[model samples]
Target chain A: AQTVTQSQPEMSVQEAETVTLSCTYDTSESNYYLFWYKQPPSRQMILVIRQEAYKQQNATENRFSVNFQKAAKSFSLKISDSQLGDTAMYFCALGGGSNYKLTFGKGTLLTVNP
Target chain B: DAGVTQSPTHLIKTRGQHVTLRCSPISGHKSVSWYQQVLGQGPQFIFQYYEKEERGRGNFPDRFSARQFPNYSSELNVNALLLGDSALYLCASSPRASSYNEQFFGPGTRLTVL
Candidate 1:
C-alpha cells in the first residue's frame, strides 16, 4: 500500500508571496504519478499540478509548480505570487502505475492573506 | 468539454440510514473513481471502476459499494452509515485507468450524518 504524508498541518502566506508545502510518499512501485489538489471552502477539488515519476522535469501551472525528488520520494508544491483565492486545503497524492486510485495525504490548510 | 460532475451537492442523513451519491464523468471518459474526505483530512480512495467493471478498491469495508454505468456515470452507495461516514464524497474521472492520465475531479457531494 502506498501512503502519502504532508507533515505541515497549516500554512499561511501573504499575497504575492511564495509558499512551499512539503509532501512525502512510501511506495514500492518504480513507476507512478504524483499530484497536488486544492480544495477551497466551496469544497471543489481542483487539480493544481501533476508530476510523472519518470520525468525529471517538475510540473508547473500558472502559479503552481512542484519540486519532485524521486530519490527521496518527496513531492512538494510551490505557490508563486499567491493570491487570496489560493487559500484552501492542499493534498498530495500518489497513483501507482497500473492503478488509477490515488492515496492522499492529510491535507495542509493554506491561508493566503491579502 | 464538461468536467466531472456530482449530484446532490449536500445531503444530511441519520446514522444507520443508507445514502447514495451520483457522479457523471466527462464525455468519452471510461473510468470513474470514488473517494471519501473526512473533515481536516485528505480524500481516501474508495472504489474505482472502468468500463463498468470494478478495477480497484481501497481499505474500506463492504458497507461501501459503487458501480459505473454503461454511459460512464457512477453511483456510490453506503449501507448502515455511521457517524464517521459524515464527510465529503468526491468523484473523479479519467479517459482511462492509468497513472499516465490525470484524473478530473468533481465538486464533491457533502454528506452529513447525524
Candidate 2:
C-alpha cells in the first residue's frame, strides 16, 4: 500500500511571488514515481511536474519545480512568478512498479491574489 | 488534436440507482484510467485499461467497474449508488510508448446522488 500526504490545507500567495507546497509519501516499493497535479475551477486535472525516484535531479517545468528528497520521502512543489492562473488545488501522488494506479494526497488549495 | 473528453457533464441519481460515465482518450492513446474525486479531496484511482485489457485496479469496491473498447474509449459503471458516491469522475489517457508519461485528463463528470 502507498499513501501521499499534503500538510497544508490552504495557502495564499500574491501575484509574482513564489510559493512552495509541501508533500510527503510512503510506499513499499523501493522504486517509485512522484507527481504534482493541479486542478483549477475548470474541473480539469493537469500535470504540473513529475520526479522519477531513480533520478537525483529534481523535476521542473517553466515555473513549477519540485524538491524531491528520496531518503526523506519528501516531494515538494515550488512555483515561481506565480500568476492568477496558478490558483488551484494541488495534489501529490505516488506511482510505482507494475501497478499503474496512482495514490494521491488530499490536496492543498492554492490561491493567488492579484 | 482535442484532449480527453468525458460525456454527461453532470448527473443526478438516487441510492440503489446505477450510473454510467463515458470517456474518449486522445488520438493514439491506448492507456485509459479512471478516478473519483470527492469534493475537496484529491482524485482516487479506480481502474486502468490498456490494449482493451484490465491492467490495474484501486481500492474501490466491486460496485465500481470499467472497460475500454477497441477504439480506446472507455466507460465507468457504478451500481448501487449511495450518497457517498456523489463525486467528480475523471478520465485520463496516456500513450503506451512513454513509460511514465503524464496522463492527459478530461473535464470530468460530476455525479450528485440524493
Candidate 3:
C-alpha cells in the first residue's frame, strides 16, 4: 500500500515571500506520479502541479514547482512569491502506474500574511 | 469548459440512514473517482469508474457502493451510514485511466451524519 505523509500541520508565509511544503510517500512501485492539490475556503480541490517519476526534471507551473527526489521518495511543493490567494489547505498525493487511486497526505494549512 | 460538478452541496442524515451523492465528470472525460475527506484530514480514495465500469475500489466497507452511468456521470451510495461517514465527498475526473493525467475536482458535497 502507498501512503503519503505531510509532517507540517500548518505553515505561514509573508506575502511576496516563499514557502516550501514537504511531502514524502512510501511506495514500492518505481513508476508513479506525484501531485499537489490545494483546497481553498470554498472547499474546492484544485490541482496545483504534478510530477512523473520517470522524469528526472522537476515540474514547474509558474510560481508553483516540485522538488521530486525519487530515491528518497520525497516530493515537496515550493510556492515562490506567495500571495494571499495562495493561502489554502495543500495536500500531497501519490499514484502508481497500475492504479488511478490517489493516496493523499494529511494536508498542510497554509496562511499568507500580508 | 466547466470542470467536474457535484450535486447536493450539503446533506444531513441520521445514523443508520442511507445517502447518495452524485458527480458529473468534465466534458469529454471518461474517468470519475470518488474520495472522502474527513475534517482536518486528506481525502481518501473510495472508488474509481471509467466508461461505466468499476476500475478500482478503496478499503471502505461494503456499505459503500457506487456506479457510473452511461453518460460517464456517477453516483455514490452509502447505506447504514455512521457518524464516521460524516465527511466531504469529492469527485475528480480525468481524461483517461492513465495515472500521469491530472484530475479535475469538484467543490465536493459535505455529508453530515447525526
| Fnat of all models, as shown | 0.72, 0.67, 0.83
- Relative to the true structure, how large is the alpha-carbon lDDT of every model? 0.90, 0.91, 0.93
Candidate 1 residues lying further than 4 Å off, grouped into runs, are: none
lDDT of 2 by residue, B1-114 (tens): 999999999999999999999999999999999999998888898999999999998889999999999999999999999999999999999997222678899999999999
Instruction: Rank candidates by DockQ, best first.
Output: 3, 1, 2
Q: Can you list the residue pairs that collide in candidate 2?
A: none
Number of the top lDDT candidate: 3
RMSD for each of the candidates: 1.3, 1.4, 0.9
What tens digits encode model 2's per-residue C-alpha lDDT throughout A73-100? 9999999999999999999988877788
DockQ of each: 0.72, 0.63, 0.81
Clashes (backbone N, CA, C under 3 Å), per candidate, total 0, 0, 0
Best by TM-score: 3
Could you give the CAPRI-style class of model 3?
Answer: high
Candidate 2 displacement at residue B52 in angstroms: 1.0
Worst window of 10 by summed lDDT in candidate 2 chain B? B96-105
Question: Per-residue error at A88 for model 2, in Å?
Answer: 0.6
Off by over 4 Å in 3: none
After TM-score superposition, the amount by which residue B34's alpha carbon in candidate 1 deviates from its true location, in angstroms, is 0.3
